[model samples]
Every structure is written in C-alpha cells, then in structure tokens.
Target: MPRRGGPPEVNAGSMADIAFLLLIFFLVTTTIETDAGLDRMLPPIEPPDQDVVIKQKNIFTVNINKNGQLLVEEELLDLRDLRARAVEFLDNGGDGTCNYCRGGKDASSSDNPTKAIISLKNDRETKYATYITVQNELVGAYNELRNREAQRLYGRNFTEMEAEFLNPETPASIRDDLKDKVKAVQDLFPQKLSEAETSASN
Candidate 1:
C-alpha cells in the first residue's frame, strides 16, 4: 500500500507518565533554601561565672513615661540637654573613659571621650515613636562622640577635606592608621541598653 506505510506508526505512550513522575520526584527531592536573618550577639542563658553586679551610681537611667516625657536620673530633662548632661557625666573625673582606657586607650588624655552605661526605661503604654526617638537621640550622641574621637586621632577633618585626600594616590599606611583610629573610637561605643533592666523598670 503506499510503500507499505512503515508499520502503522504508534506514538510513544509512556512520556507523559514519565514527565509526571519526574515532576513529582523533583517536588519531593528538591531542597528549599531558608533565609537566616540578621546576626546578633546573644548572652548565655547560664554561665559558669557569676553575674557581676553593675553599680547603680555608674548607670545613667533614661525614663520614658506613657506621656512621652523624658526623665534622666528621675529628674525631668529636656531631650536636648539630656545628651549633653550624659556626656558631661562621662567626661567628669575621667570615669567615662575608664572602659576604653582599660581596653587600651589613654582616657585622661582624650578630649570628650568617655563610655557610660545607658539604661533606658519605657512604660508599657509608651508610644513606639517616642521610644524610637529616644533611641535615635542616644545613637546620635554615640555618633557625635565617634566624630570627636576621629578628629582627635586623625589631626584633620576628613569630612571637610576634598576627595583628593581619599584618592588611590594616598599612602596605604596612612589609610590603615586612620582605620585603626576609627575602630578605636567605635570600640568605645556604649553597648545597647539591656532589655532585662528596662523590662524590670516597667
């Protein structure tokens, strides 16, 4: 018949089944990747060493009531003056700089350099915005301190200078020295206010 039309051609029958099986197999066997969130330092739940008690006088407490009023050491203070007072306390008697000094810097010699423990207390009903504002102010204080330390260490205001100062032509050794100074200042930054202490205050 028309050249005996090659053995009544038959379509392959198993491909659809094979493809379905493969799709199921892949769905079962494929590994789903999960995102690991931001890195954080968590304190030990139980420690071999006994907990050291921090002195009350050494801790500077900032209180925020439901009304968003700010109090420093139980005294109502304007937010603007609060930061200045905190800095002054740290600067006084070189106590603030002690931590950095112990960590290997001369506190007595550095100007406007000190590290004081900041304790933040917020009422349960406090507005989230108010809490954030207080936090931002504290962070701003830290940044200001860092800038002052950088100026003291670098002997120049890098920000005020032109881009030429940061060019590739600049010596690597000089860049390294600046980096170290910046690190030193950063190391002195106050640790985040302890949530445990704050919760207890409320």
Candidate 2:
C-alpha cells in the first residue's frame, strides 16, 4: 500500500499577525478613566516684604487632625455644620460697608466681605477626603452668598450668569454684559482662602 500521506501540516504563520490585530483593536477601542480632584490654581510664590496684620475677627480658622476631626474657630465641629458656619462668618457685615448684606451684623465675626479670610490648616497625616470635604464646604458657603447676591441684583443665579458668560455661541454684546455681571458677583464675594502648612503630630 502506498505510504499514508502525513497529516497535513498546520499553518502557524498567521498567529502573530492575528494577535497584533487584536492588540491594535483593543488599543483603539479602550477607554481610560481619570480621577477628578479640586480645580485650584496655585498662586505664584512671592517673597514676603513685611509682616501683614489681619484682624482676628476677619479670620475663620479651620483645623483638621489626622483622625479627621474638625476644629473650627477653636471648637470641635461636625462636617455638616461647616458650611453654615462659614457663611455666617463671611457675611456677618460687621463693618456696615456691605449695603446689600442681609447678615446678622455680628461684631465678633468678619468685618466685611472684602477682608474675610478662611484659613485652613491640616495635620500631616490627615485624610485627603476629609480635607477635600472641608474645602468643598467652605467654597460652597461662598457660592451660596454669591448666588443670593446675583439673584438680588440681576434676578438670575450667579452660576447661570457664569454659564452664559462662558458660552462660546453667545453674542458679543450679551457676553460682555454677562461678563460684567459675573465680575460684579465675584467682587461681592471674592474667595480668600488660605491653606497653611500641615502641622506635625506630637
């Protein structure tokens, strides 16, 4: 009998090409997720020329320990109450210069919006999440006041005004008008937050 033909040789030449094609497909179709963090622009470093004095009442102190405990104005405080306390401190209008202010006008709080400052200090081992939350609450306080002022002045929300100002399709004249309004709102409640060096634990 004629010798049986050897088993047909299998072709392995295209395997590498197939793998390459799959790799390319996955590379092209895959999506990458990114973590979101605070949107803050750091100020340029400047040498201090001389000591600057700030009134005690104008400064709102917030301290955070490694255990995520909050000490606001020398008192232990819960996270949920931070925003309201910040708002009260910033909008106190103690100096009577802010004509549109509807605050309690407490003499022990901030003298005016212009001079108000929120000073935040955290322990070196503090949790990042806790720090971020505290920052959010403080910023939210500013937003709340700005929104109130925007509504009273322009019959529109501050965020709405900012959105219109930033919209690319808005007409030049209208955008300019929105720009002024947004600036006015920002001037009324300028953000003046100071982040200090983390304190070392004992």
Candidate 3:
C-alpha cells in the first residue's frame, strides 16, 4: 500500500505573483483606447450685462432631431453637404468690410467670419455621434477659412503657425511673432459656436 501524499503536494505559492506580473506586463505593453472628447473652453458663468442683438442672416442654425436627421436653416440637409454649406455661410462676406474674405458676397448668408455664428440645437435624445459629426463640420468650416487666410498672409497654414507657437522649444522672439500671427488669424475668423438648451422631443 502506497501513502497518499496530498495529490503530490502541488505548490500554489507563486501563482499569485505570476498573475500579478502578467497583469503588470499587460498594463505596460497593451494599448488602452480612450473615449474622444472635444477641447472646448466654456463661457463664463456671468451672463452679459447687455443683450447683444445679432442679425438673422449672420446666424447659421443647425438642428438635430432624436432620429439623427439634420435640419439646417429650416430645411432637411444631407450630412455630406453640411461642411460646404457651413463654409459658404461662414465665408459669405456679405459686407464689403472683410478684405480677406473671398466669398461671393451672398446677401442671404453671413456678413463675415467675425459676424458668423453657428447656433447648434439638438433634441434631448439626439444621437451623440450625430451631434459630434455636426460639431466637427462647423469647426472644419472655421479651420478652412483660417487656413486659407494664413496661407495667403504667412505662407504657412494657420494650424501650423499655431502648433509652432504652442511648441515649448520655440524661441521667445519667434514665439512672440507666432503669437501675434496666431491671434491675428483668430481675430479674423473667431469661432463663435453657440449651443442652446436641449429641447425635448415632440
């Protein structure tokens, strides 16, 4: 008769250490996906003392319903055409004051980039993806114009100049010049995106 030795006396002492090492290795080597979010500077809490009056033509209205449908300027619009439409509205240059604007001066569109305001409204149940898509399109419109102007003025893209300005290694003198150029471009085509309170579905 042979004595039973507790199932050969298996060792479990190092199992937890191995598992912890594997977990640490995975944490160090594996890539983690993070949810994307917009980088926006929120407005101040205090409302303006005086209400500013904006012209209807200067406002571009983009509405998203719970069904993910787009109603731009009170008409159903396709997603593909949203960027072009927004660009046109923002660059309309209806007024003769915008010297850098190359738009056709459409009277029904915006007065200029400075006066253009994109008012995005959505239903409470609107798809987040749809809202993000529209937001990207609006921001793209502003970027397009800014790039155009920067290229013409500085021989470099506006975003490129901005990147150089933000670089930590940039020299103080060069950074100062880049800062002015960046501000000039921004002042020319300020992004005036406004979001109204979400509305409930009818």
Candidate 4:
C-alpha cells in the first residue's frame, strides 16, 4: 500500500487555483440580469390633477374577468374586435373638435380625443396573457390614430416620424420641425389610458 495510516496526504497545492478557475468559469457562463418588468410610462405626479374631475361620459371602460373574457362598456366582445372598437371609441370625438377624427358622432361616447380616457380593470385572478392582449389592442388603437394624424400633417406615418426625429444623421433644424409636428400629433391624440387596481373580490 502507498500509505498505511493517517488517511494519506492529499494534493492541495493547486486547490485554490482550481476553485478560482471554477469561479471564473461560472462568472463567464452564467448570466446575471436584473428582473425585467413590463415597460410602461406612468403619469407625472401633480397635486391638482388628481382633484380635477373627468366627465363620466368621457371615460371608456374595459373590463376583464377571470375567465379571460373582455367586456367593453359592459358589452362582451371577441378579442379580435377589441382593437377596432377601441379605435372607433377614441376617434369618435363626440364633442366635435377633432376634424381629423372620422367616427360617427355619438353623443354618449368620448367627448374628444384629448378628453377621451380608456379605463382598464381586471379581477385578481385575471390571466396575464389576456391582460396583455387587451393592453396591446389599446396601444395599437392609439398607434393607428397617431399614424393617421402624422400622415395628414407630415405626409408620413408616426413610426416614420419617430425614426426621422430620432435619427442622429438628421439635421438639427429638420429635427426641430419634426419635433413640433410630433408634439402636435401627440397633443391631438394623447394616450389617456387609465388602469385601475385589480379587484381582489369576486
């Protein structure tokens, strides 16, 4: 036998090096990322804004149940129809100020694009997929409106306008002009979505 007693001497001269190498390998192969979240822009904090009363008629309500069913203004609708309906509701311009809006004038609908607010609510058990679907449709509606307005004003779509204004190669003077146009379009059809807290009770 090579060693009779004392449990034989172990080779530990490179143990620290081996451990360091293992640690380096782990650091290189393992990915460490921060927790990702749904990207959203929150409204600014203003003392008086909360107290400002929004007209009941100006708000369009969309609710989602635990069963993943969508209810728009208390009317159950298919997911496919949500986007178009949202567009119609937002572009209604019931108060008659939106010349660019091409919706049937309904007295009970949203007052105008600026005053219109799309309120979303969901139950505590609502599925994230369904909620995201509704949110996407609403965002798409806004995008469509902004695109139309941008086309009417700038002869291009809103996405193209964004590309142009954000391009580093664009001249400062041109960017300024585009910035004004974009701002005007945004003011005309600002994203006025209001999401309420998810209800815990059934």
Could you estimate the TM-score for every candidate?
0.54, 0.85, 0.84, 0.84
What is candidate 3's CA lDDT for residue 46? 98
Q: Total clashes, candidate 2?
A: 0
Put down candidate 3 lDDT per residue, 16-61, tens digits, no spaces: 9999999999999999898779978787899899999999999999
105-144, model 4: which lDDT tens digit per residue? Answer: 7889987898899999999999878888888889889989
Provide the RMSD of all predictions against the true structure, rounded to 1 decimal: 10.4, 2.7, 2.6, 3.0
User: Once superposed on the true structure, which residue ranges of model 2 sit more than 4 Å away at CA?
Assistant: 1-10, 41-51
* Whole-structure CA lDDT of model 3: 0.90
lDDT of candidate 4? 0.87
Cα RMSD, model 4: 3.0
Q: How do the residues 104-186 of candidate 1 rate in per-residue lDDT, one tens digit apiece?
A: 23233223233356778888888787777777776666565555655776665433221333567767876676665655666
1 against 3, candidate with superior TM-score:
3
Give the deviation of candidate 1 from the true structure as CA RMSD.
10.4
Which ranges in model 4 have alpha carbons more than 4 Å from their true place?
1-8, 32-39, 49-51, 163-171
Candidate 2 TM-score over all chains jointly: 0.85
**Cα lDDT listed for each candidate:** 0.60, 0.92, 0.90, 0.87
Q: State which candidate, 1 or 4, has the greater lDDT.
A: 4
Report the lDDT tens digits of candidate 2 across residue range 1-202.
7886889888999999999999999999999997659877586899779988899999999999999999999999999999999999989999899887778999888989989999999999998888888999999999999999999999998988888888898899999899888999999999999998889998
Among the numbered candidates, top lDDT falls to 2
| Clashes by residue pair, model 4 | none
**Range of the 10 consecutive residues with the lowest summed lDDT in candidate 4:** 34-43
